[model samples]
Target: MDIHRFFPPHEGISLSDLSGLCGAELADPSQVDRKVTGIGSLSQAGEGEVTFAVSAKNLPDLAKCRAAAVFVTEKMAEHVPSDVAALIVAAPQSAFARAAAILVPDALKPLSFTSDTGISGAATIDPSARLEDGVVVEANAVIAAGVEIGAGSVIAAGAAIGPGTRIGRDCHIGHAATVQHALLGNNVVIHPGARIGQDGFGYVPGPRGLEKVPQIGRVIIQDQVEIGSGTTIDRGALDDTVIGEGTKIDNLVQIAHNVRIGRHCVIVAQVGIAGSATLGNGVMIGGAAGINGHVTIGDGAQIAALSGVAGDVPPGVRWGGQPARPMRGFLQDAAAANARAFGKKERKRGGED
Candidate 1:
C-alpha cells in the first residue's frame, strides 16, 4: 500500500496522546513524549514509525525492529526491545487500525473529484431521471430514464446507469462501469469496469436449438458492499440475486444469477459461483474456487483456494480439494497418496539393485 496515495503526510503526534486515543497503556512513562510520524510493518518500520506485533511469530523480529513505538498485547510485552516503547492493548492490530484512522482522516473518506459545475454539462441524463442533492455526475456519463440516484452519490466519467435502477445515498458508480436492473443500498461502491445486473447464462434445449431464458430479476445489493473492478454479477432468472451487507468481493469474481450471499462474506479474486447457490453469513471463499449450482454453504464455512465445491457444505467447517471434503480428510488423503508413490519408487530402485 502506498501511504502517500491514501493519506497525506501527518504531523508527528506524541506517544502519550496516541496511546490515549487508541485505549492502549504505554509501557514506559518516560517515552510518552516520543514523536510518531508514520505507520509501517514490523520488518519495514524505521525511526519515528509506529508498528505492531500481534503474535509470537513476530517476537523473533522484535529485537531487530527499529520503530520508535510498537503496539503489543499484554502477553507480548515481555518481548519488546528496551529501546522501543511498547503500547499494550487487548487487541494490538485493532488498536493500531484505530490509531491510523485518527492520524489519517482522508484514508477513511471517499475520493472526491468534484468540479466547478455540480453536474457535468457534457453528461447525458434523461429528463425523467431524479438526482438528489450533492449528486455528482462526471463527463460523458449516461443516466437513463426513470433512474433515481440518492444524495452524495457520484456517477463517474463514461459510466452508465440503466433505466429504472434505484441507487441509494453515498454510492459510487466508478468510471466506465455499468449498472442495470439493480436496487443498491447506501455506501455501496462499484469499482471501475464492473458489470452489474447483466443477463444470466440460462438456456433450454429446444427443437430449434438452445433457447435463451429471459432474465428479468433484479440484483439487490445491500449497504457497505464493495464490488471490485472487472467483476460481473448476473441478474436473476426468476428471483433476485442478493448480496448482503458488508460483503467484500475481489476482482474478476463471477456471481451467477439467483445466488444469495449472506452478510460479511469475503470472496477472493477469480471465484465463480454457479446459479442458485446460497452462502450463509460469515462464509469465506478463497481465490479461484468454484461453487457448483444449487448448493448451500452453511454459516462460517471456509472454502480453500482452487477448491471445487460440488455438494452442500456444513456450517463451521474448513473444506478443500477438487471435490471439496473436510480439511482433515483432504490432508490425510494427500499424505497417503504421497506415501504410496514413494514406496513404488523405492521398490523399483531395489529391483534394479
Candidate 2:
C-alpha cells in the first residue's frame, strides 16, 4: 500500500496556523509560510519535514537540523537559526504529535474473509468475533463456543477455546496457546509458545519426597496484558491467578498459581514469581527478578534488575541487591566496601607499614 497516497498533498498548513491547533501563541507570524510534509526527529529530519526541541539540551541539535520547520518552546526561540522556520509553541512535543497526524493519514482497510483461509464447519463461534479483511482462522480455531474478537485476531491451527472466554478486538492467539475457561480482556496479546491455564506448581511433602496437589483454578488476564513467547501462567491452586489490568509479562515469565498482580505492572523477561505472590498496582519488576512464594509487594514498588525478593516489599519503594532493600541502602552498602579497605590501610600505616 502506498503511504504517500494515504497522505495525499493537502494545502500544507504552517507553524503560525499550528498555534490554533495546539493552543500556543506564535512569536513571529511572518515565518509561518514554510511548507512542512511530516514530522521527524531532530537527528533524522530533512527538507520538507518538521522536528521539535523539547528542552535546552535539545536546542543545539534543533539549531543544526535541516528540516523545513522546527517546533520550539518560548525560551528556545533564540537558538533557532535565522534560516529555519519555527513552530514556536509552549508545548512543542505535543504540537509535533498533532502535526504528524495531519500529515500522516491512516489507511484503514475494510474487513473481509479471504479465499486462502480455512474454517471448521463444526466450530461454534459468537456473533461478535469480527474477523478483519485478511484474517486467517485455521481449522478448529474455536472462537469459544461470546468471544468478540476485533479485526485480525488470528487463531492458529488446532487451538481450542473454553466457553465464555471474551477475547477483545485484534488479539492474536498463537498456535496452541491454550486459553480456556477464562476472560481475556481487549487487546490482550498471547505469544505462540505460551501455555495458559495449566496446573499450578503445588505439592505436599509426604513419606517419600512429595505428593502432588491438584490445581483447580482459572487464569484471569485483564486488558492489554501481553504474555511473552514460551511464558506460562499456571492455574490457581484454589483461587485464580489474577493478572492486573495493563500488566505486561515478558518472555519466559513464570507466574505460579494463585499469584495476584496489580494494574499496569511490568514483569520483565525471565522474571519468576512463585505461588501466591502478590504485586501491587504500578509495580515494576525488572528483568530476571525472582519473587519468592506468598510475599506481597506493596503499591508502586520497583525491583531493580536481577534482584531476588525473598520478603515482602512496602509501598512506594525502590529495591535492589540480593535481599532487595531500598535503593539508597544498597548504594550505602556498596560505598561502605571501600571504607573497609580504607580501615585496613589506616591500621597498616599506623603500625605494620
Number of the top candidate by TM-score? 1
Candidate 2 structure, TM-score to reference: 0.68
Clashing pairs in 1: none
- Which segments of candidate 1 are over 4 A away from where they belong? 1-6, 108-117, 345-353
Give candidate 2 regions above 4 Å deviation.
1-42, 45-164, 174-176, 338-353
User: What TM-score would you give candidate 1 relative to the actual structure?
Assistant: 0.91
Residue-wise C-alpha lDDT for candidate 2, range 162-253, written one tens digit per residue: 65565666666766667765667767778766778888888899999899998878888888787887888987988999998989888889
Error of 1 at 89 (Å): 2.4
**Cα lDDT of all candidates, in order?**
0.93, 0.76
TM-score of each candidate?
Answer: 0.91, 0.68
Worst 10 residues of 1 by lDDT: 108-117
Instruction: Show pairs that collide, candidate 2.
Output: 111-133, 112-133, 150-169
List clash counts for every candidate, in order: 0, 3
